[model samples]
Target: MMDEAVLEALDAYVECLFAPQDEALEFTLSASRRAGLPDIQVSPAEGRLLQLLALMVGAGRILEIGTLGGYSAIHLARALPDVGTMVSLEASAHHAEVARANIEHAGLSEKVEVRTGDARKLLARMIQDGEEPFDVVFIDADKRGYPEYLELSLTLSHPGTLILADNTFRGGAVVQPADETSRVLHEFNLSLARDPRLDSILIPVVRERVDGLSIARVKNI
Candidate 1:
C-alpha cells in the first residue's frame, strides 16, 4: 500500500502492454466525453485484462456491480460473445443515462444492460427471480457495500466464476486503518483471504487502490 511510485510504474507498464484503442473503444471514450462524465474510465491495461478474463472464462453472462459512466462496463463487455449479456447495477439515474449513451456508442447495448437502482435491492430481486448465474462478477462501485455485493454475487456465481473487487487498497488507508472506509476495506480483505471458500489475491493497480480478485470453486459436498 505504501508503494505509490511502484504502482505508478506498474500502471505505465500495463498501458504499454496494450495497444491503442480500436474504433469501438475510441467511440466509447468519445461518448463518455460527450456525456459530460470524465471519471468513468479504466486504464488501458485493466480493460484488456477484463477482456481476457471474459474470454478465458468463456463468459456468456457477466454481473457488474457498478456502471460508472460505462467505462468498466465496456471493458468487461468486450469479452462477451454475440449472445452474451452483461447486467450492471447503478444507483444514479443521471449516471445511468450517461452510461446508456456510452453503451450505445460502444455498440454494446445489445450485449449489456444497465439497471439504475440500489445494488442491494437489485440483487435481492435477481435472487427472487431465479436469474441465470453469471460466469464473472465485477464489483467496483460503492466502497461500503462491497461485502454485501460479494456475498450476494457469490450466490449468483458458479464454482469456477471469477470475482474482481476494486479499491481494496483505499490509498494507503488499509494499512493505517484510521479512517472509516479503510477499516471496512481492510476487514473485507482479511475476511476474504481467511474465508474457507475463497482463494484470493490483491494486486496493486492504481493510487491508493488494489484490484482484489479471487478465484474459487464452490465446494459442494
Candidate 2:
C-alpha cells in the first residue's frame, strides 16, 4: 500500500493534471477561511467530481442539504443549464449570509438560492408544498441527521434522481462506531445500500482515508 502522504500527493497531482480549482472557487475558499468557518468543505477534486456528476445527469434542478459558505453549491450550480435552479439549505443564518456573498461573488446568484433554517424542517416544508422533485440531491449536514435526510430526500426526489452524501466513512470510526455520530453514519450507509428504492455505492475520493462519498440513484417510484 502507498504511504498516506504519497497517496495525497498523487491525488493532488492528478487534480492538477486534470481538474484544477478555478479562481472564483479559490477566492471562495480564502474568503471562507477569513470568516473563520469550518474547514470541512469538499476538496477541489471532489468539487469537480460533483460538477461532473451533475453534468452527467443533465441536472436542471439540484438540492443541497448543507450550504457551508456555498463552496460546493457553486460547483453544482455551475453544472446546471442557464435556466436551472439550485436551492441550498444552511442551518446557520450567519453561514447562509456568508455563502450568499460568496455565491454572488462567483456570479452564480441568479442560479443559486441559499435558504436559512434547519435542513430537516426546510425539507419537510418542501414536501408539504409539493415542490418539484430534484434531479440531484447532495446531503452533507450533521452526521446524526443523515438517516432522516436520506428519508426526506426520497420524498423530494423522482425516479433517476442522484443522491450524494459526503463524509460517510466517518474517519474510519464507522467500522467500530466509537461514538454516536459514527454509529449513526454506519447505520446510514447500511440503510442506503439495502434500501430497495435506490441503487447505491460508496465512492472513495481520497486514498487511504476512511472518508468517502455515497452515491445513490432512485428507482422508479
Candidate 3:
C-alpha cells in the first residue's frame, strides 16, 4: 500500500491532469479560509467528482446537507443547468453566512440557496411544504444522524434519485470504530448497502483525510 503522503501527491497529480480547480472555485476556497472555517471541505478532485456525478445524473433540483462555506454547494450547483436549483441545509448560522458569501463569490448565488437551521427540522418542513422530489441529495452532516438523514432523504426522493453521503470511511474508523459516532456511521454504511430500495457503492477518496463517499440510487421508490 502506498503511504498517505505518496497517495496524496499522486491524487494531486491526477487532479491537475483531469480536474484542475478553476478560478471561481479557487476564490471560494480562499474565501472559506479567510472566514476561518475548518478545512474539512472536499478537495478539488472530490468537488470535481461530485460535479461529474451530478452531471451524469442530469440533476435539476439538488439537496445538500451541511453547507460548510458552500464549497461543495458551488461544485454541485455548477453541474446544474441554467434553470437548475440547489437548496443546502446548514445548522450553523455563522457557517451558513460564510457559505452564502462564498457561493456568491462563485457566481452561484442564483443557483444555490443556503438555509440556516437544523437539517432534520428543515427537511421535515420541506416535507410538510410538499416540496418536489429532488433529483439528487448529498449528505455531509453529523455522523450520528446519518441513518435519519437517509430516512428523510428517501422520503423526499423518488425512483432513480441519486443519494450521496460523504465521510463514510471516517479516517478508516469504520473497520473498527471506537466511538459512538464512528459506530453509528459504520452501521449507517451497512444499512445503506443492505437496503433493498437502493443500489449503492462506497468509494474511498484519498485526500488530506481518509474519507469515503457513498453513492446510492433509489430503485423501487
lDDT of 1 by residue, 68-110 (tens): 7887888889889888999999998987998888888888899
Each model's backbone clash number: 1, 0, 0
Residue 61, model 3: Cα distance from true site in angstroms: 0.6
How well is each residue in 124-209 modelled by candidate 2, as lDDT tens digits? 99999999999999999998999999999999999999999999987677879989999999999999889999999997777445
Q: lDDT of candidate 2 vs native?
A: 0.91
Clashing pairs in 3: none
Per-residue error at 65 for model 1, in Å? 0.7
lDDT of 1 at 213: 42
The sequence of per-residue lDDT tens digits that candidate 3 reaches over residues 1-221 is: 55889878977986898779888878878888998889888888888889999999999999999999888999899999999999999999989998998888888999998999999999999999999999999999988999999999999999999999999999899999999998999999999889999999999997755689999999976
lDDT of 3 at 162: 95
Per the 3 Å backbone cut-off, how many clashing residue pairs does candidate 3 have? 0
Rank all candidate structures by their lDDT, best first, as comma-separated numbers.
2, 3, 1
Each model's RMSD to truth, in Å? 2.6, 1.3, 1.1
Q: What local lDDT score does residue 183 receive in model 2, on the 0 to 100 scale?
A: 91
